[model samples]
Target: MFKYDLKKTLSEKVFIFWSMIFPLALMSCFYWAFGGIYDIENSIDTRSVGVIYESDNEFATYFGDVLEQIASEEDAILSVSEVTDKAELYGLLEQSKIDGVYLVKEDSIEVLMNPKYSATDSMILKAFGNFYVREYDMIEDAVTSGNIGAVATILDGMNEDADYMSKEEGIFAQAPNPYLWYFYSTLVMGILFQAMSGIYIVEQLQADLGVRKVAMRTSVSPVPKSRLIVSVYLSRLLVALGISAVTIILMNRLFKVPVGNRLPQLILLVVAANMFAISMGEMFGLFFKGSMSSRSGKGTGVIMASVFLSGEMIATLPGVFERYAPIVNDINPATVLNFALYRLVYYEDLTTFYIEIAKIVLVTVVFLVIATMKLRRQKYASL
Candidate 1:
């Protein structure tokens, strides 16, 4: 009987589609759209900069060689464009042809930039200017002190400081990438897809509205309804966990997502998240089962609603709720699960990780118990 139930459940087209193909297909689309972005973001090395000189000025002429040297290398810090006219330089800055403008002076170099177009490149240009000024001051000091030997040591120390500044912060805790939010949302959406199996389970019951020939047979059989429900739960649980595992593997290997060093913890969170999704789905399924209406449309709506609240649909939805109706984040299963996984894989905060895990487990237990009670209470006038 168990084998028959398992086979029938797995054989359903909807089951196969939702449990496996949909996730892979969606992930493929995600990979195609966003896979190259990380590399592109990381490869940016040179910012376009325009250097305008006062014609016939010896100081500007002297700085031309410095700018050329800085920009001439294969992997240069700045791609320099020498502008002879102030009007032309302003045009380039306005059109964003140059990230920033450098005005060469006899004693100091001035930077001109349009705040509207300037971004990180502007900051890079400013840092470069700061370094040049520091080096100039050091050279002047060394010349005045008549200590050419100490100049080398001071420059070496400055170089060391620059090297330290260039080094990235700890592997995971560095600057946050906005692109990762979409990937994180995709994973959560895929896991939430597991709810489809739960809806299918509910639809199979004789008490529900759908064609229930199997449910009728099971009703008359000696095997209890509670036992059948448990089997359905287990089967879907395993399937959901399997799908999540596959998703994680593809995300890391195919998409080249940096999952970091928390593989074991990530795996545990995946399983726990799947459990929460399955049980939550069952809770909704059983509720809608009692209503005996079409479960698919309603189930899909529930799933979308969960994702929306979790900020899968809108990135700021959760944040908005957090500020105003903060408890919604705590109550929303999808938000809780997504946050738990995010914390586990990205933040690696043990305290929040364990807290989120406990919340999921508690919610799963509550939903499963409610669903079991609903199933146990079923009474058929005629089967």
Candidate 2:
């Protein structure tokens, strides 16, 4: 029965199409739309700056050294180039070869920028100049007074400040692209296709339409109803999970969705999610079997509503609802999946990951139990 059921599940063309092929196609579309966004956002860092120094001036040389030091640092904010001639420097600035030009004065540095370019890069240059000018008097005073200790202390403090600012930990952690929310939300919605397959699992067992002809035949067999139901569940579970694995692999490998280092944990989350969706599908089928005239229609509607609320369709909906009404995320399967994946990629905290897994398991168990009760109470009219 297990072997036959498995074969039957795998052989269904519509099942394979929706479960596997459709997601692969959808993933391609998602990549096309969102792939370039990361590059655009990352362009904000490491702007090019042209530096023309007054070599004889001590503060200018000092300011140039500061630029070199900053430019050499890891994940540098500026790329510095020295221009010996003012015409060449301004020419580079005009051509947009550099973001801004730094003119060194005795006490301070001046920023030269073209109005056509974005002001952010020039603003950064100006800020750096302002900060250095603000501190130059102290350095001059310390050197003239022969306060060698104070000079060392100030240089050391500046180096320490630079190091601290360079480290991108805590608040400066790299953010996932906003468009990724749509990809993740869509992935979760695609995974919910399991629930659609799940609805059929319940429908096939219940005495129903032409699709249930096999159920009618299986009922007359000597096999226990419990065993038959278990076989169906196991067969569909394997199919659903197999399709999910394919979807995830395509997303990570082909689409480059950045599933991260927690590959095994991600597979586990997929497993738990499949279980929840399948169980929910079964519960829907059993609960509404005779009650609804069009069980599939209503089931599909519910799944669509779940997907919409999960923010699969609208990217901001998830953040908006999550921020305004926290309770919605608690019940929405799509939201739970979104949060779990987000935690895995961004935080990589196992405690929260496992908690989400547990929640999915809990949801699965609840629906499974309810469906089991309904199936047990079900008595068929002889065909």
Candidate 3:
């Protein structure tokens, strides 16, 4: 029965296009449109800046020393150039020699930028100035209050070698890529498309729905209804996973998307996702009174809406929901699956991943229980 169901599923042309070909094609379009932009936007290089000293106060000297130390680091973000006067600084800025200039006053510093300076360079310079001023104010307050211990603590905290945060390595050492969101969401949409198969499973088993002939034959067959349903469900799930595996391989190899090396966890998430999607289809089929095509169309609409809300089309939608309506993300199945896949691959957050898996499992069980009860109680009248 499983083999027969598998063969039947593989032979569906609509399933082949919707689940396999369409996703790959969409991925190709996304790659061509946004791939180069992400690469250029994410790249960060050292920036050049000029520093002019108009005052020789203690704070000015200390600030200069801080800049010198930061510029000397192996992976320094700034290359510092010392200017003798404002004339030389303005000269460099006009000539495009330095991206920005820092003017060191008596107790504070000012940032002057070239008209053509990149936004990234301007932001870095401004941020450094703001941070320095804030830290200096804290130290000044400590000294004025005669808090000797606080002064010492502030100085110790300012040490360049002080470690406040540690980086935890995930399965991949690659930096985060925002563009992967589209690809992952596309993969999710493809998986959800498998819900059509679940609808078909209902069409075959329930005597009152779908094609009258096939439904009646399956309903009266000698095979136990529970056993038959399990066989069909497993077969459809295998097909979904098979397609997902191929999608992952293509995403990693062909498109250069980093799906990470955590194969075991990834497989587990996709399995749960497929089960949830299929069970959702089962619920739709059992509850909605309609022909198979009508039910399939409604399922597709719901899935598309869920995907859109999960940021499949607009990348910022999920973020908006996260900040304003977080519960939308928690309950939306597509969002849950997308978050699970993202956490699994980029964050390597197994705790969140397992939580998402539990949600999927819980929903799947509820859907299956309702669907099973409905199928079991189905009665047909003899003519």
Candidate 4:
């Protein structure tokens, strides 16, 4: 089977390239360029803070706009909110809506409310505050000291840079970076397992070798047909895990991503998910005959359904997404793995984790049962 699958197989080499080489190459690049740059964090003495403006001072408005832009970027996350009045802002603070606030005045800005927010972020926020002061002072110096009168001389003679306030504050905390694994579990895990599982199913259904082995070997060998199918299915499950394990290691070792505590559990989730997917593939395969033509349609359907229903793609889809979201997300094992990993790593909240684990197991059982039914009862021409 290995030699035959390797020889005429159009996709085998493609999968090998994607599973091994692509991840190693991509991750090595990230490790060198990004690893050190991200390590620099502000100290506890200074705070990086987000500023919000209600009526909007000139300095306040400018900083607020910059904050919004920076927040959208990867390096910084500025949580800023604008309201009509102080009353509204205060209400938000009381409700723990905003992490911290910067109230901009005519001369200076103030950080009001939450102190638990990262000290570095708060310092950066307050650095914006000092920036306003320095700019105002520079303009004041030019006007009052008559530097503006001799502006050309000052510009020509001054060789030193601006003496801006130093950035010396950072929130000192330990938060695991879950972005890498979450990205892996959500996107890569889903597509790879699905395609492999579905393709394996297709292979089994169409191959005369599989039929001959099963029909001839199982019936007389004292092994139950159910056990025979389970054994075959288990082999495929191990193969999927083998691929996933290598991919995960390459990603982690090269990129040095913090995948979180109980990494073994996450691997368990990966194994169980691939098994479920293989079982699903087996069930789907029963629909196709020896020609293997039907596998494409089924494969396409599975891919579409998995990606579409995955909450990661569209994100929001009204009530069906939020209310029945877990169910919808369950339609894609990748989503299950992602949400589970998110909980395990970042959220550290266990309620949702247990539920997702249960759902994964349930889905696996259903698919396995369906595959067994198809294998035992379905009528088909010999391959």
Candidate 5:
């Protein structure tokens, strides 16, 4: 029975498209649009900066020393150049020989950049200047008030490389990749569409739904409805998982999307997600009053809405929901699956992953129990 059902499901062209081809096409489009941006974001090139001192004051000397110290670091992103002539520094910037220049006066510092300087480099330089100014203000205030202890404390903090925050062992090793969010959310959207198979299961087994003759024959067959439902579910689930595996392989190999190294956990997540999606479809099939195609259409609407809320379209929507309406994320199957996949790939939060799996299991059981009861009570007088 499972083999027969698997063959029948595989024969459905629409199912194949939604479960496989469409997602691949969408992912390819995303890669083409954002691949260059991702590369640029990850590549950090060192910038050459020139420093000119107008007066050898205490603040000017300290700021120059700080810049020298930063430039000396092995992985420094800035190369410091000291020039005595302001005209020479300006000439260098104008000719694109240097990215930016700093002017240190008696009590203030100024940053000058070429018009064509990289925006990222400009932002970094500005941030460094702002931080130095803030620290200088703190020291100035302490000295003016004759707070020797505060001045010493601030100086000690500036001199020491103290790490206030430590990274967890299993946290995302590199900077967060914004593009991965879209890809993973799209994958979850594909998994959610497997609910169509579940809907088809209901259409085949429900006596009064879908094709009357087929449903009638299936309902009255010698096979127990429980066995029939399980067989159909297993078959559809196998197909869904197979398609998902292919999608994941293509995403990693063809598109160069890294899905992380935790293969077992990833497999677990997709399996649970597939089951939850299919079971949700089963419930929709049983509760909604319509033909199979009508139910499938409604199911698609619901899935699309869930995917939208899960950040398939707007990457910030999930964060917004987390702040304002967290329950939406908790209950929405698509969001749950997406969160699980993301955390599994990027974080050591196994507790949250298991919790999401539990939710998927609980929902699947509820859907299956409700579907079973409804199908059991369904009787035909003259079918």
Candidate 6:
């Protein structure tokens, strides 16, 4: 029965088109449109600093030259521009064009920073301030080593083991994995929609198109319902898989966004999450049976639940609602999926990773079993 059903679905061109072609098309369009749009650029750190020191006085001349040298260096992250007067810096501050400003007077440096600026942005002011004071650190180190060429060797070593540097030294890597919070949110949403496609596919076959044919005995005898559903589900599964593959590829190629886990582990999690979503969708369709005639509103309910639980609204939703509401992020499948992915990447401990993956797989399996059972019990009249 299973083979016959499978063979029947394999022959259907539309199933292949929907499950593979259409989904690939959507994936391509989505990744292209939004791939570069999503990234973890600490543009906060890109904040430019205004230097209002004059280039005339001896101290000012030396300090200003040192500031430009540091800012121009590739390793130094800040962008600097000279300001003729304090009033100019103050005016730009009001406009918020730059994050902060500095006045390098003879006695001490005065920093005017926006209160709303992030800690890391403020670090630019502090770091450069120290560099302005300790301009001879590099010269001293070079002289102590008795070799000017040794600075390159020192820098090369720093680049290799930058993370292991002492607490005083900071490590700069690609902005932490951009996908940590919202990656799973997007993944879960995509999974749900893909599964819903299968549910609709089933309806198209039996409820909408097959209704009259099934009532006709001559037409009904040649076709088995199980074979039809399986065929459609297989097609939808391909589509679901295609969407996932394309997203991963786009993230890697375009954004260079790190997903943390090995490629294989990520694929496994994506497939597992998709399976659960497909199963839940199957149950919804089976329970409702016919959307055109039944008008059960179950499909609408599914979308509504997902919207609330997807974490997009979690911030606006009150704490009480988030805690107790069934559709809140804490209880939503999207949140759970994202949490698992985050742990897999961020948490170095394997035990926590395994626990989260197990939870998601458990939920998925339960949904799949229940959905299959529900569909098996459905009553379809002969055409």
Candidate 3 has a TM-score of 0.67
Every candidate's lDDT: 0.66, 0.70, 0.77, 0.52, 0.77, 0.54
Q: Kindly list the per-residue Cα lDDT of model 2 for residues 222-290, writing each as its tens digit.
A: 787788778988998899888888787787777666665667888888888888888887767766655
| Greater-TM-score candidate between 1 and 2 | 2
Order of the predicted models by lDDT, top scorer first: 5, 3, 2, 1, 6, 4
What TM-score does structure 2 among the candidates reach? 0.64
lDDT of 4 by residue, 1-383 (tens): 44333342335554445445654554555456545644322221222343545446665666566566655666454545555466776677677676566776776767674655443344444545565555555655786777765655454433332221233211112121223432443335343434545455535543342533544443455545565565556555655666777766656555555455566677766766676666666655666554344664665576556645543333333124435444565556655666565555433235666787788788879877776766653334663
Better of 1 and 3 by lDDT: 3
Q: Kindly report which residue pairs in candidate 6 clash with one another.
A: 214-382, 214-383, 215-382, 215-383, 216-383
Per-residue accuracy of model 3 over 92-165 as CA lDDT, tens digit each: 88999887888889877888988665433554576577667667889889999999899898878666422111
Compute the lDDT of residue 307 as modeled in candidate 1.
Answer: 74
Off by over 4 Å in 3: 40-177, 381-383
For residues 102-145, what per-residue lDDT tens digits would candidate 5 score against the true structure?
87777766789886654345545654665576679899999999
User: What stretches of model 4 exceed 4 Å from their correct place?
Assistant: 1-182, 185-195, 198-202, 205-224, 288-290, 308-320, 323-327, 377-383
Tens-place lDDT digits, model 6, residues 183-220: 44444555655555545544445443333443233224
Candidate 1 overall lDDT versus native: 0.66
TM-score to native of every candidate shown: 0.61, 0.64, 0.67, 0.52, 0.66, 0.50
